[model samples]
Target chain A: MKTENNRAWFLVLPVFALVAFSAIVPLMTVVNYSVQDIFGPDDRVFVGAEWYREILQDDRLQQGLLRQFVFSFAILLIEIPLGIAVALAMPRRGRLASLTLVVLALPLLIPWNVVGTIWQIFGRADIGLGGVLVTALGVDYNYAANPFDAWATVLVMDVWHWTSLVALLCFSGLKAIPDAYYQAAKIDGASAWAVFRFVQLPKLKNVLLIAVLLRFMDSFMIYSEPFVLTGGGPGNSTTFLSQTLARLAVGQFDLGPAAAFSLIYFLIILLFCWLFYTTMMQLGRGSQQ
Target chain B: MARIELAHLAHSYLGKPAEEGDYALRPTSHVWEDGVAYALLGPSGCGKTTLLNIMSGLLRPTSGRVLFDGRDVTDLPTEDRNIAQVFQFPVVYDTMSVFDNLAFPLRNRKTPEAEIRSRIEEVAEILDLASCLRQRAGTLASDARQKISMGRGLVRTDVSAILFDEPLTVIDPHLKNSLRRKLGEVHRESRLTLIYVTHDQTEALTFADRVVVMHEGEIVQADTPQALFERPAHTFVGHFVGSPGMNFLSCEVDGGCAVVDGRRIRLADDTAMDGAKQGDRWELGVRPMFLELVFERPTEGVPVRITHVEDLGSSKIVTATTGGGNLKVRVGGEEEIRDGSAWVVFPPEQSLLYRNSRLCGKSAAGQP
Candidate 1:
């Protein structure tokens, strides 16, 4: 039964090389920048952990981190259940089923920048459809002036754009369920809610986990849509880690702090992603036992 | 338990049924007695599963009514049918423990927790899934998962009937036999109205009290297993219900006899051949087990050229060419016979005559 192990490494070598080239090299560069101070094009100085201390102490970074967490959390909370519900509503067969899926995927296909631009114009109080409708309905809606309005608009846009991915994943999971399960449920006299709770929800766990992690990471690293829409403004209300990193790197021309911030941002995303992955894996294993 | 009666049940996937060909399940009427096991037996696309689904209320029949205990439930949804169904593939909740999967229906009905526990345990015990109760269903082996699916159907005691749609297809051969026997035992002990749907003749014959043979959306015959074997109402039933299937030879009726390949074979009853005329196309059907090899030509026997011989454990199958087609003869013991010279004695009594693919009558007597 023993087999040769010579080919085992061959399969993984390419992936390893790719990851090293794309991720590791840049990560090392960021780490190098974080530990030093860049004075100018040709000048530099060693400053051990100074940028870390500065980032850790700055209230703006803390606020941006908190805002990023809230945004990711809120997106996950809204999208996961809503996506599943939409998936459940989708037809399992026929022409309409595919048509509905294509329609749901349309928002995800739009470029992120375009999505932000479209939402920015669409939510305007004067000429935008959303703003005009809201104003006509007697509600004061202004994304440019109010921080809460800006945040709400950004969150809504994110939900509208990204919930489709979750729904599509859930739809595939739902479609993969053999008709036998539903028949068994019916034979068991299961109520509609019972079937959903016991059969559909449980079956959709893996897909839902993927959806949750993807949405959370994307929302946490959100930069383009909010940047193009609100420019992180009215205040730092819509400012996420990515936007903050970009401002530090591009607007202020502080490469050292910006690199440090980028590394911190990468680590935070990596940390949360690991947490999500581990939690999902543990839940999966626990259920299997 | 409830007796199911199908009153002219017919279904058509097409919106409008302009003709008989449009129906997926043709209008049929039959009654399945409470506490009796029945199998809807047919080949693929024969509408057997469709009938089972209709009976389970998974699909509503376009025409006619379904009655449970004489109560009309034609318009009822599957959830309202009070029937348990085990589908072809295993369908356990992948994320739930086997225990929870088995307890789902009971919990849905708000059954007591203690009752649910005992029922799940009992069903799992019957299905040999007692050791895997805590394991997630998706983690189990395919056969074990299938057992859990069956257990889910069996856990509920208040169901009016249990419908099985080829439930043992994924199980190992040994397990298939044992489960079939177990199902038969369960049916006897509980007196549950069970409708099993399968294309496998052995499973249908061994597990069900009665077999309803279907062909192309029509029920050809519905009778006890013994009757279905002894007197198949249609030629399709005779051909479909046997292991090797009945060997058919096209013939023409000639004066109270059927002449095949220019050889005359007497019919069992002259009255049964009243409508048969010369030159009319007919078929002579006979089971392989009934055909006897004769060393010398008998007074009234058709000649056959032996083509091949198969050594089965308990019996030997002899393949012969008669009338330009292959026919098989099942014989017990080691009978030495040359391939090209062996001839078969078609005992007139053991043969069946068919007109227009419908069995006219059985022939008089032959080797059993």
Candidate 2:
């Protein structure tokens, strides 16, 4: 005969209830709304796979996705190398290091919407410092009237706001390396470029992976900053995926299609994150072998 | 190989050292000849690692001149000094293979590709790392990584000296002895000036041709292993070199004899007593190996109460108390020692007198 003690499961009941109430219930409601069309409180009709088909066929959603991909890719390319360079140039010890760390962390602590509002006013051609300085160089710069200007402004704003996070992560990674490695490298007669390539870069792999994945996900699902800054742009030039989903759900009240779009957006982020993680890990392993 | 000389070397980490205690290495002068293995042995915080780093050019002494083959290279960087140092913990490039790791130094000097490959092969064979030449250095066991660290030092042929800072500290106990023996063989084959720093006496005595014993940030003695064992220059050396070390007892000098607790123990015949005034302080120093425990009390033996006996397979260390002083005697393992009163005998030839921690006369048992 087997004696079983079931009281141990009681310890896990609260966590299970919390997750079900917070996550599962809302997810199931979204699934329900995705498959049915509701015209009124009491009148509804069941529609299987119609909204998914329609959202996939829509040209506006496709364009929004392309814009989102370009923005994320551009952000990653500009921030990672710049962040590493900044981290390398920063001082490694004493009062100057502490002061630099506090200054680097300042931008990350500001509210997301506040960051957008600051950049929105900061980019005005008439009164803002950024605009007056750029216009003084005698190049036509008007973000509110030109689409290209608006896109460039938004990309630059995002880089300025988020690059410090990447730099801070890289700084911590660089600090963890032992001084013995540099000493050994000096004795081995390695050049500065060799030390950076073989020693510094290899040691920073794990932190760089984290920085890439986080920046990718956050930029893909970005809503508040762009909403407050350009309001999806001067002429839909910077209209990304989250703005499109918000317009479909709340602006037009297209509940079924909006629900379908949300699911697709979540899945896309998940797929890309998996791809980034696996490819980088495979590269690391390949080097090891 | 080159003859390395340090002239008036002293180091202080502080910007302005006010007193003698602020200096890590006090002012000293020494010369290390070419093609000899020397070990710097000292306790923790005795400036052993500091001296090693200074010699390797990883650190610049506050005031000193380091000469290599009669040329001053004190201001040279580590790479320009033509010296290789293996750190206390193994340092290996995680991204590189063992073959690449060994070829790094040679490639930096712009050696031909063929020569680099041949040198790596030779070093790998000598270090028994030939089978794992293609393996990633990061994935190997600790001992293997340490061997690769040693191999990197040996791969470079242009280096005038190779320094090791407690290189085998991270290896397993069973492998430490074998690695130590391999280092001795490598030193003999390469004939390069090798300086190793370690606190383990067995490793120092076994691996180096001459050992420099350090105490309180200063080198007290530099001699062969047998000489260090038989004739220590200072009390610190006599206490530091041997297992259970040399036993010291406070004694009152009475002409040519020393009185310990109202019992007279004769000092060596050569011990100088003519210069000694009345009420002079002296100590009798004797090694445990020379002290014997006799079952029957002899006229010259002092009675002792055996407190403990430690069986060490080949020998037994008999610890006893006599006249308010502790005496440890090493005897054969099979030698039976009773727990009650026993007599301890200190050989007259093996015993010497120390005045203010300095040897009073030449050692009679071992040739100086």
Candidate 3:
């Protein structure tokens, strides 16, 4: 006969309880609300997948999804390479490196709504330095009236606000590489480009994966910055998934469809994050052969 | 092939070196012949790696010039100097395949694809890496990675010299000898100037045609292995070269005779003691292998009290005490000796004399 001692499980009971109270209960409530139609606080009717079907067919949700995809993709395309370039150009050592690092991290520490408000005033053609400069160059740039200008202003604002996070990640990755690799590269007569391609790029793969994933998720669920700056802008042109979800759940008070929409939004983010992680990891491993 | 020369080479890691101790390498000059294998032998922190790095153009000497085949290349970059160095730890491009790692230099020079393939195959076969040509370099064992690093150097035929900076430091003890011999064979076939730096006397003796012994950032002596064993130029070399090294005893010289413990020993016929100078420091050195032990007392032999006998499989080491200091003697086979009394005799030809730690032009004597 074998005797098993399970006393170790008591140590993990607190963590399980914390998760149940904080996350599981609230998520279950959302799930419950997704399958019911509430006419009043007490008069609720059961609906089976009707709100899900309505959400899947809504044209506004489709447009919002398209906008979300474009915003996330554009952010990744601009920020990843620009951040790597910034990291590479950074001073490797000395007092100047720390000083530059502190400056680069300043924008990241600002609150999200403050960032949007700052950009909102900064993009006004009447006052801000950037706007003044653009006007001095004789360009018609009104972010309020033109949809294209509004989109451009929001894109530039995000780039300025979040590129430092990616840059800091890449900087640490670059620092992790040993000096022997550079010495060996010099002995091998590797050109600058070849050294970057073969040595630096391969070593940065994991950190770049993290940066991309973070940027993608954050940009896809973006709500606060654009909400304060453009308020879904000029004719819903900049309206993304999170903003649309907020409008349905808070402004319209359509409980069933809003809950169902939130679940779909959650699933979309989960699926994309999974796809990004697996594809990047597979690429890293497949190169071993 | 290149005949490398170091002219008044000196280096200081400090920006402004003030004292003698500030410099890592003191002023020195040496010429390594074309296609000859040499080794820089020293203990740790003895400037052996510093000299090798200077030769490979990885470092610039604070004062002096490096010449390759009569061309001054002191300021040349490493790749332009056409030198390859295998470091203490193997440095392989982790993401590249074994084949690509071996072909990197040739590819950098824009060699044709067919030539690159052939060269990679040749080096891979020589290093016994043909079976792992397609395997990723980072996945190999440490020894295999070191071999790949060495193979990268060997694949470039146009190289003027190949430098090894303690390349076998990370290799297993069982594999060290065979890999050393492989490097030796590679040097022979390529006929390139090969300079190996190591602290191990066995590796220095086995791999190099001539060994340069360094101490305290200066070259003490550069000679053939046999000559280095028979005649060490400095007291440090005498104490550093052989197994158990040479035993040194302080002595006084007067009127062509050496005296230890108030007993006079005759100097050899060709030994010189030009001046009967008094109060000069002198030492007599004799290898442990040259000392003979006799059970019975002789007319003119130093009597010793035996302390211990260590059995080392094929040979035994006898530790004894003389009036002046302790002495170790290497004896063959399992000699039966008790820890009581013994007589030891030194052969005249095998004994050397030193003045102020430098080898003097003289020899000590034994009883006729």
Best by TM-score: 2
Steric clash pairs (candidate 3): none
Comparing 2 and 3 on TM-score, the stronger one: 2
Between candidates 1 and 3, name the one with more favorable lDDT.
3
TM for every model, in the order presented, reads: 0.91, 0.93, 0.93
Instruction: Rate residue A248 of model 1 by lDDT.
Output: 84
The candidate scoring highest on lDDT is 2
What is the Cα-based lDDT of residue B245 in candidate 3? Answer: 91
Model 2 chain B lowest lDDT segment of ten: B359-368
- lDDT tens string, model 2, A122-233? 8888998998888999978988888888889888988888999999999999999999899888888889998998789988999999999999999999888888988987
Could you report the DockQ of all the candidates, in the order they appear?
0.64, 0.54, 0.54
- Residue-pair clashes per candidate: 2, 0, 0
Model 3: how far residue B95 lies from native, Å: 2.4
Model 2 per-residue lDDT tens digits across residues B1-368? 89999899888999999898998998867888999999999999999888878888889998988899999988999989999999888888878899999888888889999999999888888788999999888789888998888888989887889999899989999888887888888899889889999999998999999998877778778889987888777788889999989888888777778777787877666554556766666788889999978889788877889999999999999999988389889999888778999888878887778777766654523322
Instruction: Return the clash pairs for model 1, or none.
Output: B349-B364, B349-B365
